[model samples]
Target: MIRLHHVAQTRSFRVLWMLEELGLDFDVVPHSFFDRSLRDPAYLALSPAGRVPALEIDGRTLCESGAILQYLAETRGTLTGTPEERPDWLEWLHYAETVGSHVANLTQHHIILRDPAMRSATVMRLEAKRLEKALEGIERRMAGDWLLPSGFSAADIAVSYGALIGQRFTALDRLPKVSAWLDRLNARPAFQRAAARDGAAQIYMQAFYPPPEETPHA
Candidate 1:
């Protein structure tokens, strides 16, 4: 059986959603940032970085959600798109991390550093703007219901993972197309199934984490 080591509401969700989309039967081995479980020696062997979404598939191991998704597309012989469309497919897939970087920074400011003194106000504001700028690219590019004109692909699964979490940091009201795209993604049954299996929230506890203005309040 395909085994997925995952952390709820993270990049691992990309793998979970894609697996559901492909109708592949797999088991979810949930992990948490709260616990030291991910730092365990065996988990490190699966993902040297100690990151989640480590897949034990076909008797091999795969980490990195983007690589995992691309591998699935290759094995299933779909979602990667034709030769002409491959570049665009790859762009958005990696761009997911572009978006993820800001989210990670913001998550550090607004959530990870529980003490207000531990967070940086300037960083929170700067990262939020950077995140919004990255999202604007998606807004301009989203001329259709999905990221690729060829229709739904792993690119969507890869990129949209951030949008789901990003809306919490940078408001999507200004990013209407991306917001609508997120709605479409959320409308998918497979997305729903993966979400149902995604387990309860861990890192982010609030619906919205507005940018930090001024300096840290003492």
Candidate 2:
């Protein structure tokens, strides 16, 4: 049996959405970002770092989200894109993390840090702006319906995860193409199905997280 250890709104959502897109029959083992369940030794055996998106399949477990998506595409014979588009596909697949890194920082500062005194206002603004710049790169790169001219693939599944969450930190008004692209991605039946199984929101408590520096005085 294929089992996906996942946390809602986390990188694991990439695998969850991909499984739906691939029409694979898999079980979702839900996890929470706030809970210490992931740190349990038994869970560590599946994912050394105790992070989500630890997929158990073919008698072995997968840890990283990007690697898992690539493996699933290759094994299932789908979503990898054509040889001509391989470079772009790979570029975008990895670029997801570039955007993700910033979102992670923002999430940590805005949510995980908990104590207002522990978070840095400067870092929050810097990361938020950096995230916007990274998103703008997508705006420029996306000269077509998806990341590549070839068509939809696992690249979208990988890259779009960041864009979905990135919107919480950075406004999409400057990213018309990305806004439209996200809309298209959300409209997919498979994406819709994945959304249904995305579980409760354990990470992002709100739809938007503005930088502390930007918050107005009361």
In terms of lDDT, the best-performing candidate is 2
Model 2 misplaced regions, further than 4 Å: 214-218
| Model 1 residue pairs with clashes | none
Error of 2 at 120 (Å): 0.3
Q: Could you tell me how far off, in angstroms, the CA of residue 77 lies in candidate 1 after the best superposition?
A: 0.9
For 1-218, candidate 2 gives per-residue lDDT tens digits of 89999999899999999999999999999988777999999999999999999999999999999999999999999998898888888899999999999989999999999999999998999999999999999999994998888789999889888899999998999899999999999999999999999998888989899876566869
Q: Alpha carbon lDDT of residue 154, candidate 1?
A: 95
The local distance difference test score of each candidate is 0.91, 0.93
Tens-digit per-residue lDDT, 14-72, candidate 1: 99999999999999999999889999998999999999989999899999899999999
